[model samples]
Target: MKAMRDVWGQALVDQGAKDPRIVVLDGDLANSTKVDKFAKAHPERFFQMGIAEQNMVGVAAGLASIGQVPWTSTFAVFLTHRAADQIRMLVAQTGANVKLAGSYSGLLIGAVGKTHLDVQDIAIMRAMPDMTVLAPGDNTELLAMMEWANAYDGPVYLRLARDPVPDIFGADYTFEVGKVRVLREGAGVALVTTGTQLSRVVEAADLLATAGLNPTLVHVPSIKPLDADGLRAAVGGHDLVVTVEEHSVLGGLGGLVAETLTATGPAARIERIGLADTWGESADNAYMLNKHGLSPERIRDRVLTVANQVLASHVG
Candidate 1:
C-alpha cells in the first residue's frame, strides 16, 4: 500500500523526465502535497507560488498557453474553493492544458480540520464545462490516470487522499477517460463508488456477500463524462443502486449517478452515502469514517438494511 500523493509526486517526476514541457507549481504545500519530490528533482521547472492558490492557477494557465504543461498542487479545499473563479475563467474557459492536483481531499485530513477538507470539489470541477474530474481508487490507478491526464490537452482535476490506501489495480492497469471499471459482478444490488472509498466498498461487498446479498461493485474513476452505458448495464437489473464516495452526496459521485440514471432509461432506487449537507470535524481516520457512516462495517450494515427494505417493497 502506498499513499496516492506519494505516487502522484513520483509520477510527476517520471513525467517530467520524459516531457520537458511539464512544470509544477505549488501553493506553499510542497511537503504536504508530496510535490516536493518534483521540486527537488526539477527545481528549474518547479515554481513555489506560496499560499496564493489563485495566483498559482493563473500562472499555470499562462504557462499552458505557451505550450507548457503546468500542474498546480495544493489542498483540495483551497484549489477548488479559493481559486475557483480563476480556474473557471482562465483554465476551463480557455481549455488550457493545466492539471490541478488536489491533495488531501475529502474528510480524512483529520489534523487539518474541515477548513482543509473538500467534499464539494467534484461538484465544483464537474460543473465546469471543460474540466475533467478524476478520483483514482488507489496509487496504481492514480499513476495511470496521471499519464492519461498528461496526454490529454485540456483542464484536469485529480482528487487525492491524504494517507495510504490498499492497491486496487495492478501495474498493468491502463486508465481511459470517461470510463467505469466493474470490479465485482453480482445481482439485486449494485455498490458503486469512486476514489479511495472504493477499498471500503469492496470490503462491504464481501460482508454483503456473506449475508447472501451479493452485490455488483462498480468503480467510477472519472466523475465527469461518466460512462453512462457502462453504468446502466452494470446496474440494469439491480433493484438498489448505492452510490458511495468520500464527498458530498449533493453533486459528487452520487449526483452524477442520479443525473445519469435520470437522463438514461431503466430507473432504479438510488441511495447516496456520503457527507450529508454538513461540515466535517477534526478526528482520527476511523472515527471520521464511522461518524460519516463510511466504514466497511457501517456500509455493510446500511446496505443490508436498505436491501431488506427494497425486498420488502417489492413484496408489497
Candidate 2:
C-alpha cells in the first residue's frame, strides 16, 4: 500500500526533471500535500505562496499563459472553496494549462476538523465548463493520471486522499481520460465507485458475492468527460446500480451517473451511497467512514438490502 500524495509528489519531481517548463506552486502546504519534495528537488521552479490560495491560482494562471506548465497544490477545501472564483475566471474560462492538485480530499481528514475536509470538491470542479476533474483509486492510477494531466492542455483538478490506500491497479495500469475501468464481472447488480473508496467497494463486492449477490464492479476515475456509452453498457442491464464515493451523494459520482444515464435514455434503478448532504466532523478515519455509510460492511449491508428489495419486487 502506498499513499497517493507521496506518489504525486514524486511524480511532480520526476516530471519537472523531464520538462523544464513544469513549475510548482503551493499554498503553504508543501509538507502536508507532499509537494515539498518537488520544492526540494526544484527550488527555482517551486514557489511558496503562503496561505493565499486565490493568489496562488492566479500566479499559476499567469505562469500557464507564458508557456509554463504550472501545478498548484493545497488542501482540497482551501483550493475549491477559497480560490473558486479565480479558478473559474482565470483558468477555466481562459483555458489555461494549469493543474490543480487537491490533497486531503473526502471525509478522511477529520483529525484536522471539518474545516479541512472537502467532500464537495468533485461537484464544484466538475461543474466548471473546461475543468477536467479526476479521482484516482490508487497510487499507480494517480501517477498515470498526473502524467496524463501534465500533457493535456486545459485546467485539471486532481483529487487526492490523505492516507495510504491498498493498491487496486498493477504497474502496467494506464490511465485514459474519460474511460471507466471494469474490475470485476458478475450479474444482476452493478457496483460503481470512484477514488479511494474503490478498495472498500471491492471488499463489499466480495462480501456480496459470498451472499450470492455477485455484482459487477466498475471504477470511474475521471468524473468529468465521463465515458457515457461505456457506463451505460456496464450497468444498463443490471437490476440495481449503486454508486459509492468518498464524496457527497449529491453532485458527485452519483449525480454524474444520474445526469449521464438520464440524458441518454431509459436507465436502471440507481442507488447512491455517500455523505447525505452533510458536513464532516472531527473523528478517526474508520469511525467517520462508518458514520457516513462508507465502510465496506456498511456498503455491503445497504446494497444487500436494496438488492433483496429489487429481487422481491421482480418476483412479486
Candidate 3:
C-alpha cells in the first residue's frame, strides 16, 4: 500500500521524463502533496508559489496559455476554497489545459481541523463548467489518472488523499476516464464507493455476504462525466444502491448517482453514506472517521441494516 499523493508525485516525475510540456506548480506544499519528488527530479519544470494559492493558479493559467500542461499542487481545501475564483475565471472559463491536484482530501487531515480538511471539494469542482473531476481509489488508479491528466485537455481536478491506502488495482490496471470499475460481483444490491473509502467498502461487501446480503461491490473513481452506462447497470433492477464517499451527501458521488438514476427512472432506492452538510473538526483521523460513521465496522453495520430492510420490504 502507498499514498495516492506519492503515487501521483512519482507519476509526474516519471512522465516528466517524456513530456516536456508538463510543469508542476506548488502552493508551498510540495512535500505534503508529494510533488517534492518531481521538484527534485525536474527542477526546471517545478515552480514554487509560497502559500499564494491564487497566484499559483494564475501562473498555471499563464503556463497553460503557452500549451504547457501545468499541474497546480496543494491541499484540497486551499485549491477549492482559496483559489476557486481564479480557477473558475482563468482556467475553467478559458478552457485552459491546467491540471489541479487537490491533495489531502476529505476529513482525514489528521490534526489540521475543519479549516484545513476539505469535505466538499468534489461538489465545488464538479460545479465548474468544462472541469473534469477525478478521484482515484488507490496507487494504480492514481498513476493512471495522472498519465491521463497529462494528456487530456481543459481543466481537470484530481482529488487525492495523504494517507496510505490499500492496493485496489493490480499491475495491469488500465484507467478509463469517466468510467467506473466494478470490483466484485454479487446479487440484489450494489455497494458503491470511491477513493480511499474503497477498501473499507470492499470489506463491507464481505460482511454483507456473511450476512447473506450478496452485495455487488462498485468503485466509482470518476465522479464527473460519470459512467452512466456502468452506473445504470450497477443499480438497475437492484433492490438497493448504497453510495459511499468520503465527501458530503449533498453533491458528491451520491448526488451525481441520484441525479443520473432519477433522470432515467424507475431507479433503485439509494442509500448515500458520506459526510453531512457539516464542517470537519480537529481530531485524530481514526476518531474523526469513527465519529463521522465512516469506520469499516460502522459501514458494515449500516449496509447490513439497509440490506435487511430491503429484504423485508420485498417479503412484505
> Which regions of candidate 2 deviate over 4 angstroms?
none
- In angstroms, how far off is 67's CA in candidate 3? 1.8
Candidate models: Cα lDDT each: 0.92, 0.93, 0.87
Q: Give per-residue CA lDDT, model 2, range 189-298, as digits (tens).
A: 99999999999999999999888888999999999988899998888889899999999998999999988888877787899999999999999999998998999999
> Model 1 compared with the native: what TM-score?
0.98
Q: Write the per-residue lDDT of candidate 3 for residues 200-234, one digit (tens) a residue.
A: 78877787778777888888888887879878887
Instruction: Indicate which candidate wins on lDDT.
Output: 2
Give the lowest summed-lDDT range of ten residues in model 1. 258-267
Badly placed stretches (over 4 Å) of model 1 are: none
Model 2 Cα shift for residue 130 (angstroms):
0.8
Per-residue lDDT of 173-272 in model 1, one digit per residue for the tens? 9898889999999999999999999999999999998989889999999988787998888888889999989998898899889888878665899999
Global lDDT of model 3: 0.87
Q: Which residue pairs clash within candidate 2?
A: none
Cα error, candidate 1, residue 214 (Å): 0.7
